[model samples]
Structure formats: structure tokens, C-alpha cells
Target: MFVHLTSAANAPRIRRSGIRAAGRGVRGVHCFPVLPSYTLTHQWVRELARFGTRGGLVAVHFRLDDAEPVTVRHYGTPGERTTAAEAAGRLAAMEDPRGWEVFLPRSVAAPEVHRLRRPPQVAGWRYFPGAHGRRPCQCDGCRVRGEYGGRRLRERLPHPLDGPPPPTRVLLARLAAAGDPGDSAVLLDLLHWFGLRRRRRGPVAELARLAGHPDPQVRRRLVETVWRWSSPGAAELLDRLADDPHAQVREAVADAREWLAETD
Candidate 1:
């Protein structure tokens, strides 16, 4: 089981459709695995509210299968691989789990919802735990740019090293279109970027060319792209990827097929 904290305003929609991503760009939902400490489980509630939740907040408790894969980590640190049950137990044993979180890379179905309950009105820390009376980091990398006071904070605490930002989408597309057979790094980035949005057009024809790419990883990403793609060519592409020789690629094909079926 896990608990997702969000604005109470979103509760109705969540109840109706379970807890799906708010936008196509959202990677997935972030929640803390249900810990023995209810406060620890709902630790993100207060921090989330600091960003301006219109109607306070609510907690959505849902369950995941033990064997389900998830990424667990402390805030601003790299995550480690773990199963859902392992993640829950690991956090449950911690003395302080304020900054630790579990990232579930998919939507939670309504049937998996255990309860929607109001947590303690004042639970969890405001900033990083153990960070009282210290100057909050003002670097662009440290502060959330779109939060409630983001603009004011950026103006107030500008960093000298934070130079002009690059146009991310344009450069990603440029690099992706270059199609260097050896540029697996850029291909991975482009594949992940494609997964961030739903495109019912254009992508299939372009990505289909990668079906014969030597890298099994590229073909695996191709399968994943088809998993969420809603086009005439998606099924045909999946059928082509269905025979990938690499075990991981074949496994990804299977998972993508399941996602497509569920979404369909």
C-alpha cells in the first residue's frame, strides 16, 4: 500500500478516475509507501501544500503488488531499485523518512484504492528535514521554478552561475533527428521525451525506422513508445517488436502490450 498526497480540489476527479497523471507530460505519481508511522507515510502533505493547493490537501491510499518495480530514494539523491514491498519495509524501518520517497511509474486504478482519508492537518516538514534556521538554497537546480512563490524567489535569490537556459525541446529534437547510429544516449533521451507526451500522429512513422536499429535498447524503447501510441501503425509495430531476440526487449514488448490493452 502507498499514500499519495494532493490538493483536496483534485479529490473528486481522483475518486472518479483513480489517481492518473494530471497531464501527458507528467512522468508518473510520487508517493510514499505506507509506513508504520502515519505521519511518515503522509510526510509530503505539508511540503506539497507550500506550493499552493487551492483547497488544502487529502491523502489517497492505494495498493501495489509486492513484486511491482519501483524506485526509492532520498530527495535530491539517486534512487535504488526495489520491489514495492521492499520499498515499504525499507521506509518503515527508518527513524526519519521525511525526504525519502517512492516513485511509482504508472497510474493507480480505482479498484486499487484502499481509502481516501484526511491526514493530520500539520504533518511533515516545510523544507528539507533538519533544515531549520539555514539559508534555503536559491540555485535554479534547488528551487522549483513553477511553484507558488517561484517567480519572487527567483528574483530575490538569483545565482551568478545560473546563466541563460538552453531551449530543451528544440535541441532534443535536433539531436534526435541527427540519428547517429552510435548515439544511444540521445536516442534514450528522445525515447523518454516521447513517452512524456501522447501523440496520435507523426511519431510512429519516424520511430518505425528504428525497428531495425542494431541496439536492442533502441528497439526496446521503440516498443515502449508504441505502448502508449494511439495510431494505426502501433499494433503492427508491436507485432514486429514481439520477436526481439533480447530477453529484456521481449519483456518490454510484453509490458507495453499490457499497457496498450489497459489504456485501450
Candidate 2:
């Protein structure tokens, strides 16, 4: 499951920005692009229930940096329940389990997925002060003199490509069997792009597993990808790479380790 941390104002926009292989699915109830059905009231508690019933991948996009932090319940498969604090403690203890799940439309072959709806004209102004509502006042920055004509903005997933989501193992195998250096580079680039779009820890974790690739260049590139994703195990991965045999790989690892240390 993916957990995106963003401001409440931007949450709607972020939700609408579907991944590159865009597909349509409703959030929470029937996720198209795999976003959770969110509720401000008892938000975390509801998530726990959904996780139990849905029994698949889940994404929890929360705007929890408010004065009152959002409550989170221990999410589990069917028949398990726990307090929010307990759940938080458990999640915290676990290696950062990236909640984001990647799905390629053609690979997943979800017929239900459709093209994302087009956003309304001037919908971008919704966040500006005095940019909305049916009010008559001469604010210096009034985009709408009266009621806004634009349709209400809601999160939308991208149109799905035809097919089932590809298996991760298959993708990894393809990477291993890349026909040539160029093919391998392209595959790596695609996976890296996918990881960025999903914004989770799993892809980085998987990439870390390939750190021992015979190619120094590949290992060096992997360091940058891991650094960019900045997932839970990034520090550990860098620590392991600190003694890479190749000078270039070791240099990248050193830089990444320094960055992690400085940030921490």
C-alpha cells in the first residue's frame, strides 16, 4: 500500500495526477489506480476495516500534519483488530513497508479501468482565496465574480491500459534477461520511472536486491535510484554499498551515504 504525505489542499490535486500508465478505478471502494477510499471521520479506523474486507493492496494518502494528527488503526487482514496506537507502533517497527503497489494496465488486464475524466476549465483556481463560491465582493484577486461555474473537483485515476498487471517477478526476470546493454539500461530506466510514479519503498527495496550486479555502471546507477526514492532501507543499502569494488560505484555510494547522514 502507498502512503503519500501531502497537504490537505494539495491532496485532491495529487490524487488527480494519475500514474503514467493511467487507468480508471474509483478510490476506496474500487480503486482504479489503487488509491484508498478516504474518510475524514474516523479515517484510520475505516481504513482498518477496508483492509480487512478488501484483502489486497491498499494505499493510504493522508494529510496528517494538521494541528490534530490523523488517527491510524492497526490495519490487518480479515478478523484482526487493534487500537490506533498499537497499529502505529507496529507499522513503525516494521521495515518501512511501502504501501504503493505498481500495476501495468495491459499486465493487469482490468476491463473496468477506463480513461481518466478531463479536469474542468479553470479548476486550478479552486485553491486560491476568493477564487470560488457564490459571493459578490470586489476582492483584489477575484477570479469568479459570483458562483464558480466549474464542476466540483474530485480525485481521478488515469485511464487504464488494456491487460492485467504484470507480475513483479516477471518484470525482474526480464531485467535480468535484457538482450543487450542498451536493453538493460532501458529496462532499468522504465523500472526507475515506475518506482518514482508509485512513490513507495517496495521498488527501491527490489532494486537494492540487484546491487550486486556484475556491471559497475548498473550498480552505480542503482545507487542514484535508491537515493532518489529515499525509502526506509536506503541507509542500510548505502551502508552495504560503501565497500563496492568499483571506484565509481563506491563514489556514488559514498555520496549517497553522506547525504543520508546529513539528512538524519
Candidate 3:
């Protein structure tokens, strides 16, 4: 989420300028002011993207120094047809001296899943944002167990019909066996969870292989996951990844090295 926090003294002037700019009757323009040291949280970013769908430009002015202030302009476009290349070009043109950046929301194309038009005998899995409890068993193995355990116990359970989704575990195994870059983001999240769980098998080896993935994002995530795990040979592998051509990969490797050193 992006917050606009300007100094009280400059707020009036910024507001007046904003009003005058609005009066100009621009087809697609939105303007606001943000302060230094302000954070743009993930939730707010999602909200901003949702609110800025009117296919216009929104400017975010910021105070960088007493004499020079920075201005960032955000352009919101309609529909899901905008390409990343186009968005990058638009961002490049709005280069503001005051550390301004432009953001465009891009749609993610996910794999299609075929679901029955009518509900099946057994309901499929559904993910809730923050729900946690003793849900009903839904996995193949868990469903069998539930059948033997009795319907009364299953009905009284506080959890959903499906047990905890093990997409991470299943995907990690697939990545390890197949090395599919398509599952990189899911693998990264799984690796992070694995690191936290202190699991030293399966996904760790897959993540190690991904250190050399062609996708920079995948390689970067691998570096972070490896470092977070702090597995025995992770540092040595990261040393080679540190020299990766992609800036994101290099940065992740450097951060991992620093974290390792601090821990040691």
C-alpha cells in the first residue's frame, strides 16, 4: 500500500497545485504527494492497483530536499491487455529527478484447471485467506482415514473439508524431478516455508539446482531460500550465484552472504 505523507507546511501548496491540475480536465491523470521514509506495503499496493483502473495518469509528488522535490507519476490503464514491455516504456518516460517511479498493474496468466460444472461427490479444495482450525480431511489419504474414523468426528472438526493443501510439497518434488521453471514462484514460497520448517531434503536440492535457472527471479528466490535455510553447502553455491549477470540474482546472493556472515 502506498501512503502519501507530505510535510504540513508544503501540504497546502501541494493541495492547491493538485486542485489546479485536476481542473485542467486531463483525460487520465491522478496526482498525490508522498513523503520520504514512507513505506508501500503489499496490501496497499494491491488496493492502489484496484483503485487506479481509470486509464489515466496519477502523479505522486515527494519532497526530497529543501530546494528540490521529487515527483512520481502513476498511469492506470483499463483492461488486462497491457504488456510488461509497454508498461516499462511508459515508466521510463516519466523519469522524475526527485526519485519518482511509475507503476503499472500487470495481469498474471495462471494455468487453467478443469472443474466439473456440477459439484462432485467429494468437494474440491478451497483456500481461505486466514482461516485456521481443525478442518475436515480432504486429501486422498486423509479422506480414507476420515471414513474409518467415523462421520461424527469429521462433522465436528472445525477445519474445511480438505486437509492442509500440500501444493508446495507436491510442486517441490516435481521441480526436483523435472526442473520446470514454470513453477518457480510456487517453488520459492515453498522453499521459504521449508527453510522455516528446517526441512533438509527434497526442495533444498531442487532449490540448489534453481541457482542456475535462466529466470532471474527464480535464481534470486533460490539464493534467498538457500540463505534462509543456511544449509551446510548453501554458502558455497551462493558464492557462484553472486556473480550472476542479473542484478536481482546478484543482490540476493550478496544479501545471503551478509546474512551468513552476521549469523556466524
Candidate 4:
């Protein structure tokens, strides 16, 4: 058995015409091969809600031949080729299966539709799986323009590589406040922000202070933060950190030199 979660509005039309593939290469339905845990089988309900489809969500149960061609992967990762039956077994063994999805290469016929019923609304993730407590990203690319409060939320936040850089004054104030308290995590985050947007000016003077901090992690973060730091003193700071007593900090200094070399 396999399941596809979609809007209730899609149900009647789907039953009459069958689930059709839309778009280019690797066209077909994105689904889950049924698992022993019922919630696990239809885990996409909550994420699907963000699309604002009419009449809420439903799970359409269907099946394809065991040997049918298919591909499976976690979101944002490349897919792997396998047969329908083998794909189910592969996903069943994943330690954390939350973000994985399966793709059937061909259309699901109307006759293959087995069951249609409501899927529990809260069964899956809202943005991405494992995102429950992390800060929500508010980048322009991530904003759903018509979503409730979407326009009101202009608060910028960091992602691994995206989102607007926070204001310099805000980051500087937080860094100054956290320095005395030795709040390593907050300091690391702020340093990382400096790493991404080097104004090539005043921030490097402030960044110089953290080079001698007790925590090697903080020093490593400083190395990462200053790669594009254009201040004349940057070379001296890198040299000082390159010989840091902690091996991990020294290792970071080694890697950061490559980035500095490229950018220079």
C-alpha cells in the first residue's frame, strides 16, 4: 500500500480522473509507501496546509506493482532509483524518516485508488521536519506574501546561508553584552554574521578582542568571522590564532586561511 496526502478538494476529481503527474522529468505523485505506524504513512498533512488548499487535507491510498520504477529521497537531496516494493522497505529502516518522500514515475489510475479519508492535521511538520523550536526564517524568499502575519513579520533572522544580515548596531550590542557574560553560543552566532557580511571596516577592531578569549570554540568562530575582514590587522590576528594552544582552534585557523586566500 502507498499513500498520497492532498486537499479534500482534489479527492472527487482525483477519483474520477485518477492522480496525474504534473510538470517535467520524473513526473508522478509524491507519496509514502505505507508504514506500520498509521501516522508515519501520511506524515505530510501539516506541511501541506501551508499551501492553503481548499477543504482541508485527505490521504489517498493506492498501490502500484511491486516492481514498478520509482525514486526516493529526503527533500533537497538527490533521488535514488528503485522498485516500488524495495523503496518502502528502504524508508521503513530509516532512523529518522520524517523528511523522506517517494516518487512513482507513472500516473496512478482511477482503478488503483484504494481509500480516501481525512489525515490528522497535526501529524507532520510546518516548514521542514525537525523545525519545531528553531527560530522561524523571515527572508523575502521564505515569506508567503498572503499568509496571515506574513507581511507584519519583517524580523530578519539567520539561516545557514540566506536571510538578510541583521543590522550592525544590533549585532555589535549583542556581542558586547554577551562578551562579559561569556555567552559562547550567542557570541558564535554574532561572529558568524560578521563572517558573512564584512563591511571591510570597524567590526574587525571589535572582532580582534575575541581572539584571545578562553573558549577555543569562540576563537574558532572568530577565525571564521574574519575571513573577509579587510582591516590591515587581520593577518596578525590570523597568525596569532594559527598557533592557538587548542588543536581544534588551530585546525579552524588552517581552513579559514584558504577562504582568506581565495577572497584576497
Which stretches in model 1 have alpha-carbon errors above 4 Å? 22-26, 137-264
Question: Of 1 and 4, which scores higher on lDDT?
Answer: 4
Instruction: For candidate 3, write residues 1-264 as lDDT tens digits.
Output: 122322234334444443122212122222222323222211123223322323322223322122222223433333323333443333344433122332222111111111111112122112221223546454333344323344565556544423444555675665566545556676665654554443543345556667666778777767766665545676677787988999988887777676667668
Q: Please state every model's RMSD to the true fold in angstroms.
A: 9.4, 20.5, 18.1, 9.9
Pick the TM-score winner.
4
For candidate 2, the per-residue lDDT at 95 reads 47
Local accuracy by lDDT, each model:
0.77, 0.42, 0.42, 0.81
Backbone clash pairs for candidate 1 read none
Which lDDT value does model 4 have at 32?
95
Question: Mind giving the per-residue lDDT tens digits that candidate 1 earns over 70-173?
Answer: 88999889889899999988888887778999888788888888889888767988787877678677764477767777777667877654544335466456
| lDDT leader | 4
Q: What's the true lDDT of residue 176 in model 3?
A: 63
Cα lDDT over the full model 1: 0.77
RMSD of 3: 18.1
lDDT of 3: 0.42
What is the overall TM-score of model 2 with all chains considered together? 0.30
On the 0 to 100 scale, the lDDT of residue 117 in model 3 is 16
